[model samples]
Target: MDIDLKELNLDELKSLQKQVVKAIGDFEQRKRDEALNAAKAIASEHGYNLEDLMGDGPTKKSKSKAAPKYAHRENPALSWTGRGRKPAWVIEHLESGKSLDELLIK
Candidate 1:
């Protein structure tokens, strides 16, 4: 419809702006609902459920790459195996200023 913009004041213009934003939001919500309904209908026609379609399937394991369980565990290659605090031999070598790499097993 044709309207005279000159007759509207700043307050009216602000109100119109708010109304336009609200209308756009409502339209987007309606569109999303329509799309969801269409998807549901398609899923039903195909005998597939939404939950199953979106859920983790039998072959789909977790996407997360878990950290190695024993990554932080003691290095088995070390002489002491690093199970506890440094062993007596390790301490002795350290006190002598000897490198553990030279003394300890590789």
Candidate 2:
């Protein structure tokens, strides 16, 4: 309420600063908990719990790694998913008048 910051020594000021930071963090956490509780109450009134509404639904699909569809001619270990920009080996293969089908892992 009435803190005379000017009267505080260096250590006291540092301690006060730490206390202020902790207080701010605690206040924010309390606010977030309040909001979450309000949201859960609203969700329950709508015949659903918060978790079901936020569950891993189709809209929250996780990305899976694309299987490599193409490989290096000389080094089979080097591969590409045929998704993003072509790798150097793929570029070189194309530059040599070779088709991407030539690198197919099949």
Top candidate, metric lDDT: 2
Candidates in order: C-alpha RMSD to true structure: 7.5, 9.0
lDDT of 2 by residue, 21-71 (tens): 999999999999999999999999999878879984445568999999999
User: Least lDDT summed over 10 consecutive residues: which range in candidate 2?
Assistant: 52-61
Question: Judged by TM-score, which candidate is best?
Answer: 2
Q: How far off is residue 70 in model 1, in Å?
A: 14
Q: For candidate 1, lDDT tens digit of each residue in 1-106?
A: 7767789999998998899899999999999999988988898899987667877445556666533222111454434444557766568667888666655342
Runs in model 2 with CA error above 4 Å? 56-106
lDDT comparing candidate 2 with the true structure: 0.93
The runs of at least 3 residues in candidate 1 whose Cα sits more than 4 Å from the true structure, single-residue gaps closed, are: 56-106
TM-score for each prediction?
Answer: 0.51, 0.52
User: Cα miss at 22, model 1 (Å)?
Assistant: 0.2
